[model samples]
Target: MNKLDLKVLDKQEDFFIINGKEFNIGFTNAEKERSFNRNTEEGIKELNSLKEEFGANEVIYLKQIHSDKILNYIENGKSIKDEEADAIITKEKGIIIGVFTADCVPIILVDEEKKVAAAIHSGWRGTYESITFKTIEKMKKEFSINVKNLKAYIGPHIRKCCYEVSEELKLKFIEKKTEIKKEDLFCGRNLNLEVCILDDLKKAGIQDENINSIDLCTYCSEDVKLHSYRKSQGSYGRMFSFIILR
Candidate 1:
C-alpha cells in the first residue's frame, strides 16, 4: 500500500461561515498515521486521537462503493460497521461525517441556513453517476436546503497532471457532459477530474464563488505530503476528509 508523507502544518483547518454560523472543517495530514482500517491498531489509535482532538460526538464513515448512493444519517442512525455508500448527509449537529480517499475527490457541502452538511466520495465512477448532484438533491428534499445557501469545499485529489485515464473512460465522461471540450478532458492521456466535478457543481446550481477548492493535487504534492494511490502503484493509505456541525 502507498503511504502518506505526513506533515504538521499551522493552517490545517478550513473555516467557513454559513448563515452567519461558523464551522471548522479539517483534512487529516500525511504527517501522522491516519488510516481507518481496523486491521491496523495504529490506524484505530490515530482515528481515536482525531475524534478526541475535534471533540466530535460521533464520527461517521461509509464503506464507499463509489456509486451515487447517498445515506441520510439523521434518519438511519449510526452504525457499528461502516455503511456501504458514496455519500452521507445529515442535519444533526456534533456528529462528524467523513469519507476516505486517496486519489478520489472528497467533497463537503454545507447548507448554512439549514445547518445541514454532507460528505461525498466522488471517484471517476461516482462523478460519472453525478453523486455530488444527488447529494445536493437529497439535502434539498430532506432538509429543505436551498441551492443558493449551500457552500461546497472540495478537498485535494489527484489532478490531470498525474491522473491518466483510459480512452474508453474518457468517452464515458464526454457522453455525460457533451459541452466539455475534448482537450479539457484529456491532458495528453490524463483526465482532469477536478474540472469535471466543478462543472457538475455549477450545473447543480451552486454559485461559482461559493465553491472553495483546496486546489492541491495529491499526486503532485510530495512536499506537502498528501497520499496518491497512483504514485504508490495502488498501495496507498487513504486520507479522511471530515466535517461536523458545532
Candidate 2:
C-alpha cells in the first residue's frame, strides 16, 4: 500500500525512547513492507517484536474512527479494544497501547508521577475537536495526574511545508477557535494543524518545555520512510505510535 521510492533499511529503524525507568515509547518506521493493523499476519509479527522489545505483555489497539472519543483502560478495562475511538489512556503497566497513522498526528502523553500514559490519534478532525486536551482532562480526573508532570510527544505528521488547505476549511477552523488568529493557522494556502494543538495543550496546562514534537514532515521527508496519506496514490500504509508503562 505504502509505496517507497528509496532503498529499504537493512534492519528495523527503532525510534525508541525511555522516560527514566517508568515507561517506554516507540514510533515504527515504514522501512519494511509492514502493517500494524490487528489480525494481519504482518501486523502480528511486527507487534510480537514490539512486545519483546518494549517488555510489554499485551498490545492494545482499537477500531479508530478519527473522532474525539477516548478509551480508558482503568474505567472501561481491556474490552474497550473493540470500540471506536481516537484516543486511549491508562495507568496500568505492562500493556502496550498504540495508534496507527499515515499523515495524521499520533500523540503520546505520559505522567511519570502518576504512571499514566495516553495515545491519541489527532488528525485534522481530532485536532479540531481538541482530543489531546480532552485526554489530559480525563487522565487528571481519573488518576489525579498533575498536568505539569505530563510530557507530550507529538509524533510525525504532515507539516505546513506541504499541508495545503482550502479557504473554506481555514475559515471554519478560525470561526471555531476564535482565540487563534488567522495568520497563525495559515501560511498562504497552507495550514499548520499543530498550532491549534499547541494552543490546546497550553490551555490544558501542559508546559512549553514538556511538549516534544517530532519535526519530521511525513509528506516531504526524504530521509525517513514515512507513509503519507496526502501522498498516497490510491493506497498508503500506516505507522505505529505506541507506549507502555514498564
Candidate 3:
C-alpha cells in the first residue's frame, strides 16, 4: 500500500484514508464543542455524536494505564468499560477501537486481508515496555495476522524536537535494548520516539515500506487546534485515535 493519505473531514475531525482501500482510520482535534472527555454530560453527548458520525457499530475506549496490556475486542465482546489497557485489537467489522493521547504516540495497525485492526497508546513508558510489539504478537496469535500484511501508522505526537527526557530515563531505554544506538535517543536531550518505534516494528518482521509516520509533531505544530500535553504544560485535552475494519 502507498503512504496513508490524510483528509480533513471537518473543522474538528480528520480521517486518514489508506491508499487504494477504504480503511476508517482517524484522529480528532482539539475542538471544544466536540470534546470526547466522557466526564460530563456534554462530553458524553459529543462522544455519542462521534460514534454516529463515524457509523461505528461498537466503540472500545480504554482507561489507558500506560501498560503493555492488549485487549482483544472479539474475545471481550462488548462491555469495555473500566478496562485498563494501552492497546486494543479486534477482527470484527464495525467494531471501532480507540485510544486517547495528548503527547503520547497514537498508533493504528490494520491487516486488510484479515480485516484485523489495533489501536495503541504508546507513551514513553508503554514504548519502553514494547507495547507495539506486544500488540502485534497478540494479533498474530488471536487473528492469525502476518506482520508483512499489516500496515502501521504512527500518528502525531511529541516528536524529538520537543520530547526532552532525563539522562536516567534515556539510560534505562538503552539498558533495556543494548542494540539501541546513542543517536536513536539523542536529539539534543529529546528522544526520537518514532525512530525507536520504527526499529521495533522492523524487528518484528514489518517491512520498512509498510510503516508510515504522519510526521506532525503535536508539541511543535503552529496549529493551536492540535492538542499537546508538553506544549500546554500538561493541561491539554486528549485526542482520540481510532480505527475500524470497514
Residue ranges of candidate 1 with Cα displaced over 4 Å: 1-10, 13-20, 75-81
- Residue pair clashes in candidate 2: none
**Which run of 10 residues does model 1 get worst, by summed lDDT?**
1-10
Model 2 misplaced stretches (Cα beyond 4 Å): 1-12, 16-18, 75-78
For model 1, how does the per-residue alpha-carbon lDDT over 72-131 read when each residue is reduced to its tens digit? 886355472366899988887877778888899989898868888989999999988889
The best candidate by lDDT is: 2
lDDT per prediction? 0.75, 0.81, 0.77
Number of the candidate with higher TM-score, 1 or 2: 2
Listed in order, each prediction's TM-score against the native is 0.88, 0.89, 0.89
Tens digits of per-residue lDDT, candidate 2, 1-246, equal: 112122321224545353547887777767664667664677767777877777777788788998999988763454877899999998888989989888889889999998999999999899989999999999999889999999888878898888888888877787888888778888887888888888889999988888877777889988777888789863547788988886
**Per-residue CA lDDT of candidate 3, range 197-220, in tens?**
877787788988888777677887
* Candidate 2: worst-modelled 10 consecutive residues by lDDT: 1-10
Q: How close is candidate 3 to the true structure, as a TM-score?
A: 0.89
| Lowest lDDT block of 10, candidate 3 | 1-10
Using lDDT as the measure, name the better of candidate 2 and candidate 3.
2
